[model samples]
Target: MKKTEEKIIRFIDAHKLIEKGERVLVAFSGGPDSVFALHFLKKFQKKYKIELAAVHFNHQLRGKEAETDEKFAKEFCGKLEVEFFSAKLNVKKLANSKKLSIEEAARKLRYQNLEKLCKQNSFSKIATAHNLSDNTETVLMNLLSGTSAAGLSGIPVVRGNIIRPVLCVTKQEILEYLEKNRIAFRIDSSNLSDDFKRNFLRNRILPLLRGKINPALDEAVYRTTSNLKSQLTVNERVVNHFINEFTRKKANGFEIRLNIAEVFGEIPGELLKVLIEKNFDYEFKHEDYAKINSLAKNHKGKKVNLGSGITVIREKELLCFQKEESSLTGEVEFPAGKKAKLCGVTVFIQKAEIEANPAKKKAYELISADELDEKFLLRTWKHGDIFKPLGFKGTKKVSDFLTDAKIPASEKKNRLVLLNRNKIIWVVGLRISDEVKITNKTKRVYKLWTI
Candidate 1:
């Protein structure tokens, strides 16, 4: 066996990239790198006790060339006697529609289709031909674009079900192996042009840097990224511990206690950033971290808009991170003796006889049926909305009532109210208005409950 193949096999085994009897799907682009990967996997298929399949995605940007590549991929897979799949995507159209670069669109569509194929075929793993060269280029790109430690770690060797067995070898090694075996492979014409950033780096920048600065640049970058990834793993564990310690899950979003002296440090900002990205899949910029740390030390009631519908508000001793509420603007009419779903809560109103001891049923409340109109409007509480609680003598603002109830400010905007004739009847799941409470003179009672 060739040294390249032996190294790749070792890498795969070390990472546990494949298991016996598992089905593996290879992303075949008909390029030198992918061809080498598919060939290598086919050569070792029996040894590894794995089933092999190949998939080709034509970006449709190269017209006849793209079709030719797809044809080559299919024929190549046929020669290996492997199951083949092919897809053609309008990458340009997708790029335009999504406002993303052509490369980004192609990558997104390709991976999405690959994942779908894996599910449909019950494939346990999806393998791609991302070599050492690709990893080095990725690290350089992230460095130029100003990235965090995770970004500096470059492409992951194993992300979920996707594996890169050839990642341990460089592109030159792949080409040499293919040439030695006289293997046929299609060259992507786009890769020859220096139009894209990656193409420019691969053709121009990397070669120059490798020649002038460091001939062993790829090996150096590989080592650096490996170290960064190891450190990131440790940092991530610490960040997760802090998140669990400080974060409080609320109905609207999440809260991080800032009263702790440890939370005022730099790690807390990183903890919050990770929590936001993990929960909402929204990444914040480096400047956003500084702003969050500043907000943590600021006075209460100040807020910082972190864009993408995310807001960070400083409370007395906590920092609330939540998505801006899109309150229910249109009122929903709730007829008597009916049930309706409002704001993810199922509310039911039924005619019932007032129990002798109403306090026993905490899940529901009894109200004077005569005081309600034929129908009630169910909507989010608005500013200036006020109601007199069952025990309070004077009307209190809905906002103040929520504050007094210790409801998180993030949830106050989404609080629902049951209204009769534009007057608050019940602050759903909280207090009921005194005017609507069942009394001795009440002839009919309505039972209100939410689940």
Candidate 2:
């Protein structure tokens, strides 16, 4: 074997990228890197005792050029006698409709297709030909785009069932091997056009760097990135211990009770990013760590809202975080002659006399005080807190009302529940109670709500 092939084989063997009697799915784009991957797997199939298959996604952006690539891949697979699958996608239309960039939309669709094939065909591995150069580009992109340590760590060699056997190689090395072996592959015309960010890196920036600076910059960066990935893995394992100890669980969300920085103290920025992403799925602001680090040590009851619908509450020396999707506070409004629900709270407006004003205002709905219940109480949501809604004899819990009505978290606390002593009379913004319906005895019509 040639030196490059030996290096790739050794890397794969070291990581167990391929296993004996295993089924592997190849991400075959018919590009040089992917083609090299195909050849490498072919060379190792007998020795590894593995079954390899190819899946090609035609993004349909390059028109005939894309079609030619797909045809080439199919024919090449046939010549190799490998099982091949292909899909046609309208990536441009989907991206435009979703308001996503062309690259993102295509990537999502491609992965979805590949996963479908893998699951259905019983393939345990999906291999992509992402080489070292790609990782450097990604790291640079993340840095330029305000990336954290995880971003700086660059692309992962293996994530779940997805494996990159050629991650240690580069575009130049793959091209050299393909040339020496007389391998043929189709070019993606769009790649040559600088319409995408990756393309900008590959075509414009890489050449400039190689010409002006170090020719081996990609390898140098790759070496640094490989080390970072190892450290990140360890940090992630450690952070999960904190997550298990301190995070609170909810039916619809979670709350974190401990400040992250206090315990770990100076965790690598990359590890911090990973922990935050695991909880919130987003990177922090530039000053997030500094602020968090300070607050963890000095203050109590400070609040921070990390995205992914998660909120952090600092109170009583406990830093609590919860997903924003669920709310503990609820609302209720009792309309005169009506029932309104504020999440788990219920209210009824009955016989209240609210007078009409000369100003003729529009926002508030008023009713007579007589329509309201004599007493009302707002409390936590409980199971089987049932009430008979208007137009129905059947009763249901206040718990069911908020969920059924789809009340938003922000509005839950703000909703008012009108009540008659212990019984709920109305749920604001929803139904009024039959018991609270205004009669002609009501001399005044009460305004029940206001904007």
Candidate 3:
């Protein structure tokens, strides 16, 4: 047996990535790394008593070049007598539609397709060709991007049903093995272009760093990431406890109610970032987390707008993720006596002649028409905005009012405030201002209902 083959088998055994009688699907991109991986897995198929198959995804970015790669993958698999599956996807279109980067769209689609094939074909494991250099690049990317501890761990050898047997190997080693065996592999031209972030790191930055700084950069990164991953496994247990105790499920997403007194000094920032990612799918930077941690010590009602349309708001006793309509805009305005759709709620505003007094309701709010002297502005609640509830003694800040009402901080941002002539008249869906209350002297009423 070859040294490379022995190393791969040992790595697989160490990770327990595959078992006897299991069917493995290879993500064959026709690239050098994947080609070597496919060959290595094929060599061990009989030794491990496992079934092998190959899958190719052509992200339609390079037109004819992508098709040629797909063709190469199919032909290569056919020559090896392995079952092959191929797919062509409009990755550019998917990226534009989802507002994701081309790289992110391609990766997500590729894994999604691979998972689908695994289930359809009853494959037990999906193997990818991520190598030691890829791990180093990923760690550098995470460090440069201000990611949490888990992000610095790089990619895992086994993530769910996906496995990477070549993670312990280097790209140079794979290339050498392929050359030694005289195995032909297609080269992706895009990898040489520095236009993409990963390519920039792979072809330029990483090589320069390795040559100038440390010759064994990949090995150092692999060891560091491995250590970090071990630390993360221990930290995850504590973080999972916090998540379970403090979080509650909502119709939109998860709500985390972290009590300032109990949570301020107890939780680590990295763990908090992981919790947010696990719950909200947002990759928060260190600065983003700095602002979040600051909220724990700062005065209540402080909020920060994180990227990816996620907002974190603070309250007296809780810190929660604010939920809003996915389609809601920054500044929203609604005309009087008209129906409009805003924030997934269809709100109708029409003048009505109510008999002297009407029953109090939860679904609608009826206010004196004279109160709406100016055009209605429907927008998110801003700090320092005050409203006087119909029966309350004095005006109160919207934030304070919501907190006092025991409203989850996450729902506070979704509470729209209707302002007239720059005065808050209604904390819509909650309370009508004292100035807008209906009385015996009220002649007309403006009714608001959500349908």
In order, what lDDT does every prediction score? 0.85, 0.71, 0.81
Best by lDDT: 1
Error of 1 at 126 (Å): 1.4
Task: Extract clashing residue pairs from model 1.
Answer: none
Q: Kindly list the per-residue Cα lDDT of model 3 for residues 23-85, writing each as its tens digit.
A: 999999999999998988887788889999999998989889999999999999998899999
lDDT of 1 by residue, 354-394 (tens): 78876654888889988567798888888989999988999
Best by TM-score: 1
TM-scores of the candidates are 0.84, 0.66, 0.73
Error of 3 at 183 (Å): 0.5
lDDT of 2 by residue, 343-404 (tens): 44444434433443434444333433454443455444455556666666777776567657
Candidate 3 root-mean-square deviation in Å: 6.3
| Alpha carbon lDDT at 366, candidate 2 | 41
**How far out, in Å, is residue 342 in model 2?**
12
- lDDT computed for candidate 3: 0.81
Where does candidate 3 stray beyond 4 Å? 212-214, 258-267, 294-302, 326-409, 412-451
Model 1's alpha-carbon lDDT is 0.85
